[model samples]
Target: MAEVEAADFETAIAECGFGLFNVFILISSVPCLTAMVFSAATLSYVMPSAECDLKLSLLDRGMLNAATYAGMIFSAIPWGFIADTMGRRVVLICGGWLDGFFVLCAAFSQDFLQLMVFKFIDGLIICGPFAVVVSYLAEFHGKKHRAYVMLFVGLSVSVGAMILPLMAYCLLPVHIFFNVGQLQFHTWQIFIAITSLPSLLSGFLHMFLPESPKFLMSQGNYNKALISLQRIYALNNRKSRDSYPVKKLTDATPDRSDVINNPNPRRSRQERYKLAKKKFCDGLMQLRPMCSSPFLGLSIQVYCLHFCQIMCVNSVRLWLPQIFATMHTFRIRGMNDTSMCAVMDHNTHGRPIDTKSMEEECDIHQDPDMYIDNIVVAAVGLAGFILIFPFLRIAIVANHILKVFLFLSTFLVGGLYFSKTTLTTLILSSIYLTMMGVCATTIISMSVVIFPTLMRTMVLLLIMTFGRLGSVVGNVLLPIFMQISCIAPFLWLCTLMTIAFTISLFLKVDVQQSLN
Candidate 1:
C-alpha cells in the first residue's frame, strides 16, 4: 500500500466535518458565557432590593458592584498561566464549579461584607472560563466557521443579559423568606441561587467534552490529538472512527518555545520538586515573547481597545439597573420633563423629603418600568447581533463593523447626555451599550484569528485583566463623577469610546483574511 500523507492541524480539523460536535460545543458555551454574565450582573438587580437587607449605602453599592471586576483583574494573570500550562477544559470545568459554589455562598451572605467577599471570590474563579472558553470554542472550528461560531456565542452574552432582567422581574417581586438557623433568607437570596445554576450547569456540560485538539497538537501529543479529532469526526459525521479520514497529523512544531517537556513519573520527591520549579519557570518565560518584537505592538493595541471597550460597556451595563431605577423614580415623582442629570440629583439627596411619601420610590415591584427598560436594552442588543450575523461572513467585515460601532457609540453617549425624557434616554443608552458590547465581541473574535494557539489564552486573559481594570475604574469613578456632575461620567465615557474607535483603526485587517 502507498504511504499516506500526514495532514496539518487545520486540515485535520476541517476534515472533522462541522455537524453534531460543533453544535454541541456552541450550545455548551452559551451557559459558560451566560454564567459569566450572570455573575457580573447579578448585583445590579440584587443591590436595589437588598439595600434594606444588606444596609448598603451608595458607596457600598459601588464597591459591591466593582468587587467582581477587582477580583477578576487580580486573578487574570494566574488563570492565564494555569490555562496555558494545564488545558482549557480543565480551567473551564474547575472554574465553572467553583464560581457556582461561591455565587451560591453569596446568596447566603448575612451582610454586605460577606456578600462582597463571596462576589470577589466569584470574580476570581469565573475569569478562568470567561477567558479560556473563547479559545476552547474557536479551536473546535476550522477557519471558515470560526468567526461565525464566535459571534453566535457572543450573542449568548446578550441573551444572558436579557435573561437577567426577566429573572429579576419574576423573582424580585415574589415575597420569599425563610429561616436557616441564625441566617435570614429573602427573595433576593433565591434570585442569586437561581443565577448560580448556570455556572454549575456549564461545568456539568463541559465534563463530557474533550480537550482542544489544537492544544494537544501544540503539546506534541499527536496521538491524543488524533484521537480527539477522530472522536469529533465520528460524532460530527455520524460514522465509525475507522471510517474517519486523516489517520495521521503532521508533526507541527509548537508555536510556543516553552512547551513543557514532562519528566518521568517515577522520579524521586526531590527530582519532582525540581521539575515543578522548572515548569513554573517555563510558564513565566512563555510570556516574554508577547512583550517583545512583533507581538508587542499588536498586544498593546488590542489591550488598549479591550480596556476602553470594556470600560464603557461594563460601566454602563452593571449600572443600567440603577439608571433605570432613577428614571423610574423620576417618572413616579412626575418629573417627566427632567433630564437624566436632574434624576441623579434627586437620587443623591441623602434624606427623603418626607419618609412616608417616598417609601415606594425605589421599590422595583411598583416600578416594573426599570426591569422592562433593562429587558428592552438587552433585547435590542440581542437583535443587533441577529442583524449583524449575516455580515460576519464577509472578508474584513469585523474591522469595519467594529469601527462603525465605536463611532456610533461615541455619538450615542453624547446623545444620552443631552436626552431630556425617559424614552429618549432609554433608547440612546440601549444603542450605546449595544454598540460597545458588539465592539467587545468583535475584538475577541479578532484576537482568536490574530494570535497563535500556545499564547492565545494568556494573551486573552491579559487583555481581559486590563479590561476588568477599566471596569473597576469605571464602577468606582462613576458614582464620584455623578456626584460632581451627572454629565461628567457621560463625557468620560464618550472620550473612552472615541479613543477606542481610533484604536480600532489600527487593528490588523488580515485577521478576517486569516479566517477566510
Candidate 2:
C-alpha cells in the first residue's frame, strides 16, 4: 500500500479562502439580530402614550418584561436537543416563522394575558436559532478564524437594539386607528407587524443558505460536506466546480469523544439500528464528564459568568429606554406650560376649546434624539465589537483583556447609578454597552474553546439558559429595586458582579485553543 497524508478539514477550508463564502456565512447569521427583538418590543409595545397600554402594576409589568426570557429559559435545553437531532436548518426555518406569527398575534392582544401568552410562545422556539447561530457560524469557519467569526455573528444584539427603537420612534407617535370585527389596528400594532418581518424572512433566507459543512461532516455525510466545501470554494474563488481545488475532506485528527462516527458505507438495516442505539449510548456517556468532576466545576463557573454578564447588561438595557422617556418628561415638565396642546372638550362641552384654554396637563413633546440615542448606544457596542473581537487573534491578550474589562464593568455600574444628567447617563450607558460587547463575546468564545464539537452547541445552550434565567431575575427585580431608590438597582448589580469578577479570576480557559 502507498503511504498518504491527509489534510485537516479546517485546513482544506482555509485553502478555499475567506471571501464571498465567508461574507455569505456572515449574512446567514444575520437572523441572530432578531434575538433581542422580543425584549426591545416591550420598550415600544407598552409605552405610556400607547393607545392600548395594559395599565399594569409594578410586579405585573416586571413579569411581562421577563415573560419572553422565561419561555427561553424553559425551552433552551429541549431546543438544543432538537437542533442537535432534527437539524439546525429545519429548527431555524420553523422557529423563525412561528415566532413571527406569535409576535404578530401579540400586536392585537386584548389583555395582558393574551400578549404574554403570545410573547412566551414566540421566545420558546425563537431561542433555538438565537442559541445555535453562533455555533453554526463558527463551525463553518477554519479553526484559525472560528472564534472571531462567532464574535462577529454576536453583533446581532447591538443591531437589534439600534433597529427596534428607530422603528418605534417612527410608528409609535402616529395615532392611526381602524376597526375590523372587534379588532382594532393602530400605530403600535403596525410597529409590531414591521418588526416581526425579520422573523418571517429569516427562515426563507435560510432556505437558500447551506447547512454548516462541519455539521454535515459530523453526521458522517462526508460527500455532502465536500460538496458544501466545493460550493463555498466556488463562491469564494468565483469559479466553477472544475476549478474547485479540494477533491475530498479528511479529518486529520478524528474526535475520540464524539459519539456519532462516520457511518458505515455497507451496513445492513439491523446493523444501522444497532449503530443508532450505540450512538445514543455514546452521547449519554460523553455527557458524564461535563456533568462531573473537574469539568463540572468549570461548567458551573462558566454558567455563573454568563448569568452575571446577562443580568448586569439586560437589567440596565430593558429599562434604559423607559428611563430616557421619563427624563425627557421631567425636562418637559420643567419647561413653560405655554407649549401645551389644547385638550379635547368632548367631556365638558360639545364644542372646540379656545387657544388660551389649552390644558397644562397635555402630553410632553418626546425628545427627537431618543431613538438616535438607542442607535448610538448600540453603535458603541459595535465599536467595542470591532476593538475586542479582533484581539482574540492574540492568544496572550485575549484572556487578560477580557478579565481587565470584567473588572472595569463593576466600577462602570457605579458610574451609571450616579449619573445626574441625561448626557452623563447616555455616556455611561454607552460605555456599559461596550463592556457588554466584550464581556458577552468572551463568554461565547470561552465556550468554543472549552467544549469539543460533540457537546459544544449543547453546552452553549446550557450557558445561554443560565444567562436567560439571570435576565428573568433582573427583569423581575429591577422594578422592585427602583421603588426603594434610584441607585439601588445599580448598587445591587455592582454587588452581584463583584462576585462574578472574583470567580472569573479563577477561571482557567484555554484561550489559545479557542482562537486555534
Candidate 3:
C-alpha cells in the first residue's frame, strides 16, 4: 500500500475560501441577542411586577432572579461541551425551540412559583446557542476578519436589546381577559412572548447551515470537514473549485494525527476517546496551573474586569424599570399640580369654576394605564442605543468611559428622583439607553478577541458563567438596596463602574490592529 500524506487545515480553508453568508451569520445571531434581552429585561423587572400582581414578598422575588441565572451559570458549560462533542448546528436549533417554549411558559405563569420554575428552565435551555454561535462565527472567519465579524455579532446583540424593549412596549399596552377572571398582562409578559419569535426563526435556519468544519477536522474526519467546507463556500456564493484544501490539514498536524500512527499510530477509537478524556481530566486537575503566575494573573485581570461590568449592569438593568416607574409617578404628580394651578388661575380671573367639584376629579394618570404609555421610554432608549454602536470600538479604556457615562446618567436619574423633576428624569433615561447599548457591545466584542483560539470556547464559557453569576447577584441585590433606600443600587453601580474603569485602563490589550 502506498503512503498518503495528510491534508493541511488552514490552506484547505483558505483555498476553499470564505463564505458569503456573513449576513446569514449576522441573522443567526439575532436569536441569541434577542433571547438575552428578553431574558434580562423580563427577569430583572418581573420581580417587582410579580410583587405587584401576585403580592409575593420581596424575598421570593429575589429568589426568582437568583434562580434564573443559577440555571444560566449551570447550563452554559455543559452546552459548550455538547457543542464541542456533538456539533454546533444541532445545539443551536434546540436552543431556539427551547427558548420559544419557555418564554411562553413564562407568559402564562399562574403564580410567582410557576414563573420561577419555568424561567429557570428557560434560562438554561435558551442560552445554549448564545456562546456557541459566537464560537462558530469565530471559527468561520479568517484571522484577519475574526474581530470584525464578532463586532458584527456584538452589534446584533445591541440591535436586539433595542428591539426587545420596543416589542415589549407594543405588546404591554393592551389588556387580555379570561372566563375565570380578567387577567391583566403587562409589557414584560408580552416582551417575553414576542421575543421568542427570533429564536424560532434561528432554529429553522440552522437546519440548512453546515456543521463547523473545524470541529470535524478535530474529530479526524477530513472528508467530512471538506464537505462542510464546501457547504460554507456554496453559502458564501464562492466557487468550490477545490474542496477545503487537504494540504493545510497535513501541515497543521491536528492532535488526532497522533492517534493514528505515522511513526506510532496504533490507537483505536476507544484509546483516542480515553486520550481526549484524559486531556479533559488533565485540564481539570491542573487547577493550580490554571491559576499559576501568568495564567492566574491574566485570569484575575479578565475576571475582575468582567465581574465589575456584569455586577454593575445586573443591578442597573434590574432596577431601571423601578426607577422609570418612580420617574413616571413624579411626572404625573407634576402634571397634576401644574394643571390644578392653571385651573385656579383661570377661576381667579373671573372664569366660572367649581372648585369643590374640581377637587373630586379623579386622576387616572397615576394608574397602571399610565405605565402602558410610558413603555415607549424604554423602547425609544433601546432603539436609539442600537443605532449608535456600529461606530464604536471595543476598546477596554473606552469600556470604562462608557461606564462613567452611564454613571453620570445614573447620577442624573438619582438627582431627578430626589429633586422631583420630570425633564431631568427623561433626559437621564435617554442617556441610559445610549450608554447600555455601547457598554454591552464593547464588553462582548472585546472578550471574544482577547482569548486564544484553542481555549476560546472554554474561556467564553468561563466568562459567561462567572459574569452571569455576578448578574444574578446584582439582580437579587436590588431588593437588598431597596431595603436601605431606592438610591443605594445606583450608588453601588457608580462605585462598581469606577472600579471597572480603573481596571480597564490596565487590563485591556488592543487586538483590533493585531491579528491572532
Give the winner by lDDT.
Answer: 1
The 0-to-1 C-alpha lDDT of every candidate, in the order given, reads 0.82, 0.68, 0.59
Regions of candidate 2 where Cα sits further than 4 Å from its true position: 1-5, 35-46, 50-52, 242-248, 252-286, 335-362, 365-369, 512-516
Residue 375 CA displacement from its true place in model 3, Å = 6.1
Clashes in model 2: which pairs? none
What TM-score does structure 2 among the candidates reach? Answer: 0.85
lDDT tens string, model 1, 1-516?
222368887788888878998888888899999998998899988777787566567788889989998899889888998888788999989988998999999999999999999999999999989889999988888878887887887799989988999998777867778998999999899999999988998899999999998888876777778789989989988888877678777755543322334446688999888978987887777677887878899989999988988888777788778777777766666766568777667656632555454456535333555688888998999998899888888875766888988888888877877878878978988888777777888888888877777788998898888898998888888888888987898899989988999998887655554421
List residue ranges in candidate 3 displaced over 4 A: 1-19, 43-52, 179-191, 218-221, 241-247, 250-293, 333-420, 513-516
Between candidates 2 and 3, the one scoring higher on TM-score is 2
Model 2 lDDT tens row, 262-346: 4457899999899778767765654566777776898899898888888878787776665565555556656322111111111
**Best candidate, TM-score:** 1
Q: Candidate 1: how large is its RMSD?
A: 2.6
TM-score of every model versus the real structure: 0.95, 0.85, 0.76
Sort order, lDDT high to low:
1, 2, 3
| Candidate 3 per-residue lDDT over residues 1-516, each given as its tens digit | 122245455444555455567667667777666676666566544433444456555567567766767778889867766666666778888888888788787877777888888888877876678778887776666655665676566566666656644444444434433433655565456555676677777788787677777766655555566666666656665555253234335423245544433434677889888987986764444244445665567767666767777776655555555445444444555654322223223222322236443222212211454344235555565565445444444444434554565455445434433433444444555566456556555565565566543345555667777777888877677567656654565577777766766665675445463212
Q: Give the Cα error of residue 429 in candidate 3, in Å.
A: 3.9
Candidate 3 similarity to native, TM-score: 0.76
Q: Which ten residues in a row have the lowest lDDT in candidate 3?
A: 357-366
Q: Which TM-score value belongs to model 1?
A: 0.95
